[model samples]
Target chain A: MSDQPTGVPREEYRPSPSDIAPKLADLQVGRTVVTASIPLSRADLVRYAGASGDYNHIHWNERFAREVGLENVITHGMLTMGSVISRIAEWAVDPGAIVDYRTRFTSPVVVPDAESGAPDTPTTSLEMTASVGAVDTEAGIARLDVEVTSGGTKVLGRTQVKVRLS
Target chain B: MAVNTELQGSSYPLAQPFEVTREAIAQFARATGANSRSHFDPESAAQFGYSDVVAPPTFAVIPAQRTEALYITRPDAGIDFARVVHGSEQFTYTRPIVAGDVLAATCHVDGIREAGGHAMITTRTELTTADGDEPVATVVSTIVVRGEDA
Candidate 1:
């Protein structure tokens, strides 16, 4: 878990670009660079719905999810997509450096409800691994192939991210 | 019910401008667990050569979805929102979206077809500045609507 302080503006804890951005000269194709596990809970679904203006009840209401033939409440595809890219932004050191991103949603991330005993625990996590797929020295661009899975099943397929190097 | 195949190649422009704001960017960043300073502080964003707080790349979907609603909500579209599932998404950005940008989107229905007991619809949304018409991003999305019997 991130040790970032709660209730404080994130800018106060900002890392300088020089400290975070990877050097293009040092990058090698096929090298695994990023790995992370992102946890999700029911509260996160509600928060994402409010933020993205996607008030689909299937994301928050168990009854509605069942009515829609879902096993349980599920995470919004965009929420999962949006959350994983932050790690890439950190690796590239600048959010603006990313120019293209694409993914195929192959499976739904079913976020189970909290157990009777633990109300605040996370229901599941997304395990992610990203590697450099290609590097264009003349264009100053690098492409990354990211694999994201939940419960040992792939959720996003053929995921690719392109970043411009400074 | 199957989606209206006639809507293919039709375009729907958003009726209202989407005014990007710092608060909205901050909220989206928090919800997605993006802790980048450029997404939260104007000063940091300025240092990074942006006019205001920078929005995460995926933020474009907010406006893109609104543009798509013009088609999705039409009676002829034959979409049942509850049965729709996101299939794929692709985004190509000219630059990162920043706070203070007034934007608008026009969604184009690229194709609609039935396959394996599902309706697959593809849409492309072009997001541009409301004032100068500068291209910001292009979002392509595919949604699958399951057949009733399936």
Candidate 2:
């Protein structure tokens, strides 16, 4: 398992919808809502593979990845997609608030071997930022446009999240 | 090998119901680093008006992909699993999944076409409650199979 905890403790971050209502009320189009740098290590990939039941060797075996024409072992697109959405959920103060989410796998986040570094050390970090793309006050829904990048290159494109605020 | 175009437009209904459990939800939440209490604590979820622990947004992919496998793994489907790469994914949910709900997915291979010698396959999966068949979520996935020569 990955030793690094990527998110805050549940107790410290819990907020009811009533609690987050004010924050949602202040939402403005183009306002930045969340910014995070989530780290990914090989162990994290292994853990996700187990949990998601997606054990494609390209995610865990370096040689196999190269044979498949990839630059190196890469993080699963679904893993990246899944991990980044947590930021929106945290910001909305409700995991179930999100009704729509989508992303294009524009590029791979290559995870190099950790032999030279500590086993738990991250191979790369996903730099994620989400901004209010649109706010529909009547419908009480907000559209969030998320940008996810690794190694200063966009990995996921058109990453959009729609959350119910009311 | 090129993907079997004949499989396109085919639909595969769920082979069995997937019983959602708190333990599985917690494991997936931990794995994805989603730390919301609604994913683990029933009390917190109840506070949000859910009957039980609520699954994270992307949790639908778990059961959806299982149904998708029934199509992609067929010998006639012609997908080279080792060479397949995710292209895009989208999820639209009618409701959030909660623990204790029995879910089943029906997968449709919506499209399959050759692009630049590679196979571009698209699938849409509908996930619903097993008993009442209440629609919970729909997952759309696109995967590309790299050509051997490429």
Candidate 3:
């Protein structure tokens, strides 16, 4: 369960909002290729389970999680969906411009093991691509087509967000 | 799936209030891969112009779930919980909810219909200040109960 997978490194994040161009300046419209990853741990699963009241044993209890055919403790699909929201907020040219977002849970994130805060397992690598789904400068609004994945698995629920930007 | 058209637009009240605490916010931050200092530390939150550790925008679901019970468990509404697969989740925030804001979420069955071989029910939950005077955000979530096939 603690095996490290071959792909990306631990806890990698990129492209803070300050790094992006004026999203609506010239209004570049097309697909965006982005990749990021986050470390998974028991602390996260428990916290989310409590906050969201999911209480699904597969998300926490290690033994129970294994019995259910999971590689390790499974992260709540909602939690992963929530993490996607952060990437959106971070990617937007205006950090606070996110007005709405919606999506379904198509995959479950496996909880990774760690040793005293040292990563003991492989992190969930997210390779996502976004495209201009819509643009309305007058409304300061834009929508993006999104697809997320963990490892080679495509996380279901193609996500989209409506945002207000500069 | 059979039809339940009358259930459309039926509104329900929440039995409990969502208590916002600094610990709750921190817990949510850890799980969501949010490395933002403001969500985990009160001092940082205050520096960000918040009263205390502010929860991630998606953290609203914890409190929102407290109200979802009304719609999901309505016996007369003819919903079979075992067949429900979360169809969608969406959120809109008016502002960041600090640790002190006591939230109350009320669920309204905005609409219901039989579609794509499933019963799709739309639920709109309003997370508001306890007195219901100020609005925080509205979570519009929909679920589809599969018709024997799903």
Cα miss at B117, model 1 (Å)? 2.3
Q: DockQ for model 1? A: 0.64
Give stretches of model 1 more than 4 Å off.
A2-12, A116-120
lDDT of 3 by residue, B1-150 (tens): 354668787777776677898887766765665556666666656654677776676887877766877767766777766455567788887876788888888898887888777888888999899889999888888877778665
lDDT for model 2: 0.87
Candidate 2 stretches with Cα past 4 Å from truth are A1-12, A21-24
Please give, for every candidate in the order listed, the TM-score of chain B alone compared with the true chain B: 0.97, 0.97, 0.92
- Look at candidate 3 and tell me the lDDT of residue A89: 58
- By the TM-score metric, which is better: model 1 or model 2? 1
State candidate 3's DockQ.
0.37
Residue-wise C-alpha lDDT for candidate 3, range A68-165, written one tens digit per residue? 45567777777777767666655662323566777776766666666444443444555565666778888878887778777777774758877777
Model 3 CA lDDT for position A71: 69
| Candidate 1 vs candidate 3, lDDT winner | 1
CA lDDT, candidate 3, residue B74: 66
| TM-score of each candidate structure, all chains considered together | 0.95, 0.94, 0.75
Better of 1 and 2 by DockQ: 2
lDDT by candidate, in order shown? 0.87, 0.87, 0.68
In candidate 2, position B49 carries an lDDT of: 97
Clashes of each: 0, 0, 0
State the fnat of candidate 1 relative to the true structure. Answer: 0.63
Considering only N, C-alpha and C atoms within 3 Å, which residue pairs clash in candidate 2? none
